[model samples]
Target: MSAPTEPSRTSDAPGRGPDPRAERSRAAALAAARDLLIEQGWSAVTHVAVAARSGVGRTTLYRHWPDASGLVRDVIAERISTAHTPPTGVLRDDLIRELDGLRRLLHDPVSDRGLRAVIERAGVDPVFARLKEALYREGSRVFRTVLDAAKARGELAADLDPDLAVDQLAGPLMYRRLLAGRAVTAEYVERVVDDFLAAHAPT
Candidate 1:
């Protein structure tokens, strides 16, 4: 008789706890894909090569991600979803806090570099552009919500267009980040908040 056969490994197996090894492999694959995108642009990223770089198997990667674009979408969402919502007390205070958060994010080397690369890639890739637009829309909605709250509280000019106001408030920060590559310092945030409030406050 043949020797007793070992149980086949599967997603549901007795005595098998959560697969920490597989989790690490997936994380490594995502990290490798992100690093490759940052270093070599999206055109050079490949699932097989990402697995090799990540020390994972091609089958493992394919098991986790249906395609390279899907993997990239996950990576982008993971990286960019860290944006925090500003508090909702006062309009000026909220804007100041939001700008401070922006400053912190802008100064982070990995995030800053990744954002610039993604933004540049968005110009050429429609999918990336759509992702960027979605991110912007979400952020804009948060700011508009805060502004609407402020309006209800009689803190802002009654006739202020929330969308346009958000644009004015955030445009300078984006310009500095994307064009000048300047650090978003506390003083910079304070100055912008002051200028914005002065211009938009109820008279």
Candidate 2:
């Protein structure tokens, strides 16, 4: 008779966790993908290119991502979702804190390039369009969280739309910093916060 079969090995099995080497490879591949995305545009990040740059085997990448979209999606998510500020219970202050974070991020040349690539590619590339949809869904989570808290505390109208608020708060910053190539100064941030508060004053 055949020998008793052993249970299939799984990462979730007791004492069986992610391999350090695999994790390192994944991090390296993501770094490579981010660099390629920013430096060479969205079309440059293929499995072969990423494997060549990251020194990770193509088979490994394919096993994990299955296609370039998976890899590119993750890189874009990381690019946009880098920071999250905890709420201070004051709506004005919270908005300022979040906008300031955006100001600083947009000011960085590397981040600026990445954001431009994402916007540009997402406009033209169908693959990036899908990724962009998924990204924008959750990218403003921190800002939404802050608004929800304000509504709960009677600091904002219950009927206010958080999605519109996100656009209102971030649209100016992007138009100025990215499109107009202007500096995002403290005064500009203040003006933005003031306008938003005026528009949506607490009941």
Q: Report the poorest 10 consecutive residues by lDDT, candidate 1.
A: 1-10
Per-residue lDDT of model 2, residues 93-191, tens digit only? 888888888888788755666667667878777766765575566557778999898888877788889989999998999999877988999779989
Clashes of 2: 0
lDDT of 2: 0.76
Error of 2 at 139 (Å): 3.9
The clash numbers for all candidates, in the given order, read 0, 0
For candidate 1, the TM-score is: 0.78
Model 1 Cα shift for residue 188 (angstroms): 0.7
The numbered model that scores best in TM-score is 1
TM-score against native, each model: 0.78, 0.72
